[model samples]
Target: MFGPFRLTSPLSGGLLWKIPWRMSRPQKARQRARLRHVDKVVSIVDQALAKKGTTTAAVERWKAEMPVEQEMLPRDKYTIFDRKEKKYRKGIHKLPKWTRVSQRLNPPGY
Candidate 1:
């Protein structure tokens, strides 16, 4: 045994373990409700898709609600073209005005 020469992660401070969590009543109810809603929606979609010859009204409505893809500008420098906003927006090119330790947290090469 290599005494004190331990292979452990610095991120875990040489110790790592799982903490068992008990879900409260509200949390359990919320998860169940979300899962039930998703299951219902999926089943409806499957039924609509199963009938081959004629397209169901629900399928047509869903297709109409689907969003269309938009064109995007090449992301090289600062500004990016926002598809939803229909505008060019600024990104990582803003001037920093941090004092003391705050200045160190700026993105790499900034």
Candidate 2:
């Protein structure tokens, strides 16, 4: 966008700034939604960390705070529906809390 025509003689040169492109309404809305979701997660994590006290706490404390490592067993087959995917998830509650697992960590109720 910055071409030779953008340039001017010293007499005509004061400032030649480029105007930034703005997002469309839909794009802006989507970005705002994503930001809100991220902010919500950050706030929850901050609160959890604060409530958990020191970084080096007891094993029991860590166990009480962290999410379980096992797959969640839903009470019913159709506990939740994913709107974005446009599909019905059966036994959705039977999903795991943590994507990764270790021998030590497990879900709270598990």
Error of 2 at 68 (Å): 29
Q: How good is model 1 by TM-score? A: 0.30
Candidate 2 Cα lDDT to native: 0.39
Best by lDDT: 2
In candidate 2, residue 7 scores what lDDT?
42
Clashing pairs in 1: none
TM-score (C-alpha, index-matched) for candidate 2: 0.30
Per-residue alpha-carbon lDDT of candidate 2 for residues 3-33, written as tens digits (9 for 90 to 100): 7666455336675434222334664355344
- What alpha-carbon RMSD in Å does predicted model 2 have with respect to the real structure? 18.1
Quantify how close model 1 is to the true structure by its C-alpha RMSD in Å. 19.3
What's each prediction's clash count? 0, 9
- Give a tens-digit lDDT track for model 1, residues 31-77: 34443454467557757677655567765664464221111112212
The lDDT per prediction is: 0.37, 0.39
